[model samples]
Target: MNTAGIGGTDATGTSLRRLADALGTEMMWAGARDRPIGEVVIAEPGDVLADLPGALVLAVGARGADAITVVRSAAEAGAAAVAVRAAPGEDGALTPQVKAAAERAGIALMGIAASVRWDRAEADIRGVLERGAADGTSGHRGDLFSLAQTVATLTRGVVSIEDAAHRVLAYSDSGDEADELRRRSILGRTCPEPYLAHLRQWGVYRRARTGEEVVDVEELPEMGARRRMVIGINAAGRPLGTVWVQEGTRGLAGRTEEVMRGAARLAASQLVDHWFQGDPGARLPSRAGLAHGLLTGRFNSGALAAHLGIAPNASATVVAFDLREPESGDAVSQDARRAEAAEIISVHAASYRRSAMVAQACGQVYAMLPERAAAPSSEGLLTRWAEDLVSALRHHLRTPVQAVVAGTAPRLDDIPAVKLRGHHGLQVLARTPERQVATHTALTASLMVRDVLGLLDRHSEIRHPGLDVLARHDDAHGTEMCRSLLLYLDAFGDVGRVAKDLNVHPNTLRYRVRKAVALAGLDLDDPEHRIAAMLQLRLSREEPGTSPFPGG
Candidate 1:
């Protein structure tokens, strides 16, 4: 049959011989090579009597079995053909009885090379069947098929288009000059192993993921190809796939690049359309986009709540996860890692009955969870939930994940501010020792002081009188009196703990605290004065200038 006859003009069905050839296998005994195969099946032992009319049956584990009985049973079951794995270097593996049974029953018998993986063989046969069906119905006029043919005709080179995962979606079949690599890739419906290795070695996958529009490979070793060009098909800055053209001995012209780019754009549209048609929401803005709008205060509370399926006045908490990768990792690996982490988080969050709208933004995955109105204590529950999530993520991913839980927002409109607070918690945690979970409340004082210092015009103005006095005394005397006082107050006057934290003797720390209080003229016994001193001390560390207190 001609190429057009095999995949174009014919409409009956794919023949047994065509299926075997597509799999790169041969018929052991050709009973009826022209018989049309309607479907493919992988049959196990004792399944020979299964109803598989007009289907090509692959009998796995057929070695050392009763071949005659299996073949006759398949034929009785209305199978078009039966294929068995051939033992290496054993040409006469199929017994005479098996051949006679196949011939008498009018069933085609085929032998697949032991070296061919069953999965690849099955995929190849499926591809052939799909092409045959398309041709029989539409006759070389399908969008993807026509695009492939056009690319080949224009460049006079082999063409293949693959999705991001390297699965072959379409390819042009140029008759005689098609190389071995192209043949294998097209038949298996995926890139060949050796070629994938080569691409990885040259960092092609990394460059493709970095949003590069055009990538040129000067040479592909051992493929008998001179050069190749790869064009990335993208939508909304995310890479969809790539179009690859292999230049043969006849080099491509200057205009070939421009033409290929145009073709790539068409292919991208087709891919995106297919994706949207498959999943209706893909055409709409993604959850990430919505979350970003909320974070940037771009959407009103009512609209955002309606979209998120929450009440306008509902309280919510933002849980942010920072998925870190090694500095040496490439962009491709980093993206894969992040995606894996996000999927795990989504699954776990659902299991907890916390239906979260997860989104990726600012190098973190944010899950905005609505708090139940009747819950007694939302913050405590949220903190504990974050701790559990961090533990689960670490156990599954085998890497440390930092989780920051923001305080509950009073209403949906306050989510943007709460998200900012969550990020601030993350920043504070970064300066401390390694921790799995950090809540906004634990760092409230630090955050408040940082916020105040950020607005100060100059560092020379002291925020509190007592803190200023201690600061000057420490600077002049070259002593850690200010540090001792802050630690003493932070510990709630627990001298032993404060001394240990400061790495100093308890008596020394106590003396410094008393001397510092006396020098600053502060009364530590009064609740109001102690609160005022703590606030001033916290602010002093952030900025060396004026006290925020009204009076000395």
Candidate 2:
């Protein structure tokens, strides 16, 4: 079958790596990650594939043993890739035979996640090819509302798009013909949980989640809900924040199915763009495993790099960010807030570096700026670009953001050590919010201090006895003993500066300091006591939610 993509390996050709990276690893696991596929064709159940070089042949409805046959035939047909689908619980990785077929025949095998509609996967893959041909610029990117409007026009029904959690992302303009469910979902941006429970109770959600078929859910008279057809939007197993589409119209099931199926694919393309381009919340958990592994040094670097389409030997810069939310904002989920910051950074990253990839882990979002080996040393350039990212985030989010740009170009194998350095820098930034952006090189002293603080955190027994008397006294008496003492200690007994900062006479500050020292039972005359007292105060300030990667 012809797809709205290239028919040969020419201008529209896309590498398997690009496809996997664009749509995410959840879409398909390739036997080989490097082959270029220009065309997408769906194979009937019994078709003997032949003479289809550079084609991504979708073995639709072919599973188990039949899928194995399609793999072998794809090898004979000179296809660039053969895709097969699997349900949620099935093993979808490449088999030994499939691997051999690809190795010998230069045809990679693709294992499509069960929940993904074949049409969606095809559109997603073809989108990768067409977009690549257009110099990585997509004409129809990130427009779900328009897509929803088109689906409404085709199905003659009111349509709405919601994430799997039932948060409505977009909807089509509609008249009173729209059901109450559609109206509520669009207005509230959430579906009623009880009605969703009914979908689960009748296995409607499961069918929508696991199948490409548009689920026909009849009206629940008891609940006063009207009839609607729904489909689950998933790129892969991780659910990608899950997409749930609803159509509320009558007498068009047979015809609407095909149109809705096409709509699902188009929506998948847009969501995939959101997922990769900037929507950190979508399918993040599914992709987070590998990202976390690579960032934390827990996973095999080479394998993770290949899976992420990262070149192991490529020199790369990793930027760490800490987005401190404003004091007050509307009630939004943490994921939503994180995505907002990440989306802004992602926009800057994409514009600055074509090879940049963004992911979230350690309660922080990271942008991996991949640099080619032969590229000029991006010493000053990367830092400047990162500064722009921080500025953009600050302006757009109206939040204080600290961005730490790693100076050393670390390859995959060095990621753990590099991530550690940046992680320490972030921890330091959590305490010092004055600096907007700091380089890893400049954060050396702060990073060490932060590391020592971490040791105290891990070994609670090593934690110092804080200034309990002074803190409690200030709390009760409305005094500023703790603040005065910390400012005095931080200034190295600079009484004038501390007094000016406190907006008080120097002698008044001196009196308060003396009283604080006496009350806290600390000897200010001794240097050891001064340093120990400062450490104690700093440690005391290290409370919950203060760390950069808090609860990471």
Candidate 3:
């Protein structure tokens, strides 16, 4: 945890003045402006008593008299200050009783914005506490949140860090200058779908997610989105996230991009470090667990939907992410890379959609997009988001990340089937690497072929027994009959091509082909036999040492 409060270092700790600046929007309820805060404690609504001397108590889930009771107890505990949520837009005007309690107990009181989430508030306070104790000075802490503040100051704009998926990570406070879009995003802990859609419509997300140069966004009045300047954060050619500077009530400062570019590089390093070490204090992975449950049908979709704050029957946009790696790569490194990709997707999912859930299943990362209770048009929005996600992952992972959309599942029960389609869609994409993102509907023909190949791969009884007989003949005699026959069929009986391909004589190829047919009692003239042979041979390529009979 980082230290709490800023500036005016004291024998106890930093003063409240520095603390208020550390928390850009926290107002004074009744606290001494110079109260020294040495530590920060998270107070449960009813239980605030502890040996919390010189600590700033953040009373969670408490309001009015309930919060005042904690303040009284904290003061008795010798706490330096207690910060409570103020009524929205009213500062501490309605908390006179709370203030009176603090005054009587000789304890300082502080008012954090009601709109500020308790968890987020605690995070900010923790940053101040952890950093302050390290330096024993400056209220300012060197963390992502403080960096957000520094970026905001340099650009004279509201600043935030967003991953390639457009999820806002830690954003700075712009007070009254913040627009409705930023306010709602902070309040809900995600950017609104409609607003993100608006940005995508103008290709703003593309340039921001893919490139390192600063990209500008004009005000989108239709969506109530303010202008924003986006610069991609990159390290070693892999995107970490983006540094976003939004125009507040004030215009941006001069030479903003020059300073922002350097800050962006620093942010990328910090982000990469954070990914490697991670925050122990981050919220539990309940959302991910619920998502995994939904993907694997381990939990009732209705219940999971309720937990994720989605409607009971909302449609799910299922997209599967597959990380491309070498076939012979170390298994440990491959698993590690997959885990890293999952982490990258999961972090962005938190702030990308209020209900977005990412889970790993069958060695692939699956994201259940924001379940939309609205019209079906929202699927288009989700699709666009998925496309951008693929692009972002390519930049961040620096690998061929194949994403397959399974289309929208109208019912929760159908999501598993949809997930299967996405899984198969990835298989179809594996055969065609020319494109990275594809819809299941777009590859129907290819998927059908895959299904046929899968049948041959899975059920050996349905295969022509002749092929197995022919393969045994080759294994026993060291002959190339089956290989010649496969080549002959592949070339449509073009003897010259087959012989040249094998560096064998044309007469030798024909003799071997005839011998393979005779040994297996194979009917080369039958179209069905030829088609089955072609597919089975293709499947054999996937199974080493088992050619002429796949999955044998």
Candidate 4:
């Protein structure tokens, strides 16, 4: 097959020949092939491109004042793309000129800035050309049947998108390295730094905002054995993810790059299909395929739960989160920086056997903490657990992802209530930016408690004995006494204020409150009992309807 890329071979002579043939220019002075461009390219202003004979002479040097004259001379020579070398301090001003000139001349104005290593560039071009030739038969027919067969034949290993950072999307490898790579990236929750750095340099993430594909790969770190990687973006030019392949030193780098590009395009198509399907459930891998595989019954719950001690009576809370990345913005540098800020939640469920059950559900995990002596009163233990969990997740994931605690756990049956609380917590977090952590304490501590109590009042299952009796007695008497009593309690038992609020006499309001206390089977005289009765009444109020809780 036609595979065109520097597959671990000397391409300098060939690159120089290609450049010479394209421009029909003679080499002025051949510098040492091993010498860095900075040392060889900075002889003198006149000596630079002196013997070269071409209308355009691109001086690919590092960005500096020395390259200014070379760039101007190239433009004056009528070269469509007068690319200059980018130095540490140099700005790629030649790009604009190349674009303008290329537009006018109807030719490509590639910005071959010094940012690219010429040696790598030469190998890349050769590799691309060779692969193109191989893919092309006697005619312009691109035969991919063999390639397709090879891809499907994953006896050695299979490839798929695992994660994407910046424009460097990661691919699952087939060998030991690939397995280790996947384990480290997904299970370890480690940052793909090398990939991220490449994207940042190429401004691929930034360019995605404007709907542009990022095709730069010169800076990718050496993956020990020679590996070629290419990342593709979505239709919106945002990185859908990356594709990588390892084709030993047998001149497969170019072929791998071509394959990755094809994979990226395929991945993009899959993404669009996923969007149209509108099934959020389809976006994640099945838990059956995951490490613990709890969701798919690969792991038995009874034994697992028993082993983890996540029994029916264990107190646990459910939490949920919506993770998203910042939108790519204008300015390539800024965009790339922001694109790097994708949020992913890391759960420690992998570290525990039965706990993985929580990890597989709702994309959220659970922790069966040591039992506390008392259920929380204010910002209870459950709420504190949520806070601590969020803190630990942020630290482990190394990203600032937001999570809300849904509810606490007491047993398996509590899942429904916990899921509901999780949903409520998510809602509260969405509406309350300042309140990043959504614990039951935070919810109970808010004015929304009044609203929450009102909701509970409407639920047939939620029966506050003391509050229900008082309500029933008031209803039977055809008196607005319960409302008055609740108002009085809400106002801290202020009779004058309750009477004024009810537009009635203080004596009348006091009589109603006393009647409520007697009917509710509670003592109005005992402070502690009165407080408990008041809280029960508040919890029994009707609440506005939302979705049924998740687990329920």
Candidate 5:
């Protein structure tokens, strides 16, 4: 079988001299001098001419019949040229009849040395084709530059590397060879509006974000891109960017497609490195950087305090703000809103006349503020501040905002723990309807239950056997044994009060509680058993639409 074209052009179009040089043999070219050889085919006995079009037909061991007749038949069948094996120490010769037929039909006849193996000749030709495709101008020599240049050289086109946001990161310098849109993209640092619109219509960005490897685009004359190929770059399962190549005079070859795949991998590494290095001002420590460092355990309270200029005895509170965005907004619009909300919260925190460090992380805004001595209580001050901030933000953005204020951390070392508690409070508030603000001190039970639930979720095998039995009983039999027991414990086993809340007689409540303890194998007399059971019940009731204890 013939090898596929390597460069964007046909292998048959290669010069006869180039093919002979690759094979390291002397050849006499006769008849049809410059015609391209589309393929190399080994000749067989009967009527091989039918399969000979655009082929370099190889004739070996042809001493049986008239070789001139085979050459004339091949030329008639549109074979580009014929390569015949020469006898020992002699140049291969064609009769006048064969040369006349070749000259009439524009087919070149060549002779190969007898010592050269046929398989070696075919391998050499394939290598020549592959190398020709990879060779290009020396200007594209660096890592990214070479990639861009190699892509262009392979496809005979222009290339651009762009972030997910369509910001142009790099582009091949094709000089006058590039089209107007290509030049505009490089100069404006982004794809032009017309071209971007076309890409949007084609769902290019959507495909890129979803980790699609390559997207081929059809001709869009309005955008001046005839045919385009987009290769998405990704890192750690997230989209990094894309490499887009616009076709030049021809479509991309198989070799060019392979090169683009390699380029995408290289682009992913470059993008990850850029993210780690961050932007221009990233070297200087900033509030977000400090907060992130503390959250990830890269820094401690002492370093944070020294940077914020807080006193040793100062009281600090960690507050987190979770902004709600419109459900219909796209990712880009949602990001813009998040940035705006973060900026507003940071400005408000700075206005408190105390040392404040504000940061945004995990899709929420966090602020650590040192309380003034004159404040009535750290919780009271933070509550008032959070309420005011919420109202201002709601009025400005016309969206709901939730805020959580953690308990005061008296020592600098306690700030990280305080921040975690604030996050817990925020999560609890998220589940509660129409209740935006929460304080760590007030939601202690809910936070504790939430933490226990999280642990149980991750390590289900560690669940309390008694709680599991009771939960399964409630789920299967529609019984209120778990609810009654939880309320009984919450009311401190006050028979009268617990009965009133459960809407049952005191004796009846006691009997149900005894049944629950027996069925779940719980020793209610043990304080640890009571606490664990109470926490499990609370988690079950925390689900949406769950009814509270019947009365109080």
Candidate 6:
């Protein structure tokens, strides 16, 4: 190995040979004298003691009978590492004794018989030094290499700054890409002034055209907050735009700052580059108007899909991300500010191999998958992809986000209609606080139960006027649990048994059965009464409570 990499320069071969002779070592060859010691060995002589350390090297001639003697000498010399270097192609002649002796000394012994010249040795020294520098970065040289590999993999398809926008750019090697990711998008349309101002005051404020601070704005808009997350558009610590962060979370604050700085640098560089090259993309249309148009087929899906390289018959899915209400300090209006939001949404969708489109009508964006024969049917896949998208957007946007899905479809033509249906699903989501999806499966399951109850009502002989009232009360109150209890009781008032099967306490179970009986105005022990209660619960589920059941 070239000792140059270990911090040594090439020394005169005659001098080295003289030193070797004085040290009672063989001269080996003429090449050994001129070989460069490009790296300095930091062993300090004490680290090179006779005991076995983590590393050992035993350099020797390729086919000499003294090879074993050289190995034994290195081990005895306290070399923790040993490498047996022989004349080219002499490795196969290495004996088991050499291996056993090295193993017994707890020293690593590698056999390499490649003929080395000054140039080869010098190159080896440089590689060794580079490896030493890498070790100094963290002692885990392997981990650093693995991290670099991962970063390469992650950034593999990253073709442009546009593709890098929403990704957590990190050097998976040195965590550099992580910093790069944070930096890449923080800088927004308005430059260092707005972001710098936001960072200075630590609250939301607007930056005037002249870069003057204006604090009169009630709260920072979502875009402002997002921009702040990306690139603290602050100048002299004064915010050019407003900034808001979750209070008391110092780690998040630091992360936010890192993200802002990285974003600012990337954004500024790109902005300058764009200025020189001339930007070609047009301003985006209003998402609300876009959505309304798409619903009405005013937006040409085929033309847009074709432009995006999507096949006509490919399957797709629509995802709707709903923004959270402005927190205590947010001043952005959803209708007027959506370009950044749309871009973020698009970036995230693209991460999942989904082509993104923000429709204007209901503030919903869809990532449609094209070119596939049949898209995924599971809402879980869509929901997971949506969550990941939202999270990535949040790092740059820092606004509250919620998402809903309309499940995947089998064809592109089905998206607009499916999207319209998805809008209705969004209404249901808005009416509730759940973040889980409301898809065709959930909707169909509820509908099927209702239809079954409708059939029972129509077929039942309960010919009583009060039947309608009983049905409505159960419709309002008797949910899946009540219906389940009625069925269980009908099996026989086997209280202890039903409780065990349902995983509930007996008394808790009895109360529910009694409650069901009272709600239905039926006697549990009576066959006709039990039948009526069952029919009532079933029928109530069918008639949406507002509808009048014909049988009743």
TM-score of each: 0.47, 0.44, 0.49, 0.29, 0.39, 0.37
Candidate scoring better on TM-score of 3 and 5: 3
Clashes of each: 10, 2, 15, 34, 2, 75
How well is each residue in 1-552 modelled by candidate 1, as lDDT tens digits? 000111222226687777667656343546888778765566556653666667777666665455566677789888788877766455334656567777999899887667766645664665677777655432222445556655665566778888777766677765665666766665455676788888899877777666535678777557744477888777787777788887766766444565466566556655675545342123223445775677656888778777655667677778888754456648777776676666555544433433355666666777777766566246677778778767756765677788888777777778788888887777666554368888888878767766665555355464667668788988898998877887788778899988887898999998998898898888898887787676666556653433332111
Give the residue spans of candidate 2 off by over 4 A.
Answer: 1-293, 296-299, 304-310, 326-344, 372-380, 397-399, 407-409, 420-424, 431-434, 454-482, 515-525, 541-552
Worst 10 residues of 5 by lDDT: 1-10
Judging by lDDT, tell me the better candidate of 4 and 6. Answer: 6
User: Residue by residue across 1-552, what tens digits does model 5's lDDT show?
Assistant: 122211222443555556565655456567655555545555544534655556667664443244565676677776777766654443224545555656776778776656665544444554554443334311111234445654565456788887766766556656455666775555444677777887898898778666535788787766665677888887778887788887775556544455566567545645664445442122223546865675444687676766656665666777888886657648777776776676556545644533566666667777777764345255677788788778766765678888888776766567677777777677677666376688888888766656676776567566678777888998999989988888888888899988987789999998999999998888888998887787667666655554332221
Ranking by lDDT: 3, 1, 2, 5, 6, 4
Per-model C-alpha lDDT, please? 0.66, 0.65, 0.69, 0.40, 0.64, 0.42
| lDDT for model 4 | 0.40
> How many clashing pairs in candidate 2?
2
lDDT of 3: 0.69
lDDT of 4 by residue, 367-415 (tens): 3232332552233544554455455445434445456555555544445
**Candidate 3: regions farther than 4 A off:** 1-284, 325-340, 343-355, 370-388, 424-435, 441-465, 487-515, 535-552
Q: How well is each residue in 1-552 modelled by candidate 3, as lDDT tens digits?
A: 112222223455766777777777556556576777765666656673767667788776678677878888888887888878777544333367778888889988877776777656765765665566556343222345656765675568998776555555667777778787877665434577898777788886667656456888899876677888888787666777777888987788665665466557546645664445443122224555767788888888887776666788788778888987767658888886776677555434533553556788888998776566565535456567667657666875688898887787887767788898989888767765667788787878777876787777688777677777877777798877766777788788999987998999899888888887787777878998888777765665555534233222
Task: Name model 5 segments beyond 4 Å from true.
Answer: 1-315, 324-329, 371-377, 408-414, 452-472, 491-518, 521-529, 536-552
- Name the lDDT value of residue 59 in candidate 2: 79
lDDT, model 2, position 114: 67
lDDT score, residue 200, model 5?
Answer: 90
Candidate 2 C-alpha error for residue 219, in Å:
54
lDDT of 2 by residue, 1-552 (tens): 322223235434678778778987666564677777766666756876777777778877776666777777877877777887745545433556555655666667777776786646655665566567556322332245455655565456777776555666656666666666765554334676788788779987677777566787888767656767777666665343333334454544334565565556445635665555553323333355676677677877787766666677876678888787654546466566676666555545644654455677766788767777677345577777677668756765677888887655557767667766777678666666777888888878766766676676677676334477677888899998877888888888899988988899999999998899989888888888886677666766655765422112
Among these predicted structures, which one has the highest lDDT? 3
lDDT per residue for candidate 6 within 396-514, as digits (tens), equals 45665556576665656567777766665654455444453455455554445445565755676544444455546656875445545554744577777778767888888877766
Residue 103 lDDT, candidate 6, scale 0-100: 63
Order of candidate numbers by TM-score, starting with the best:
3, 1, 2, 5, 6, 4
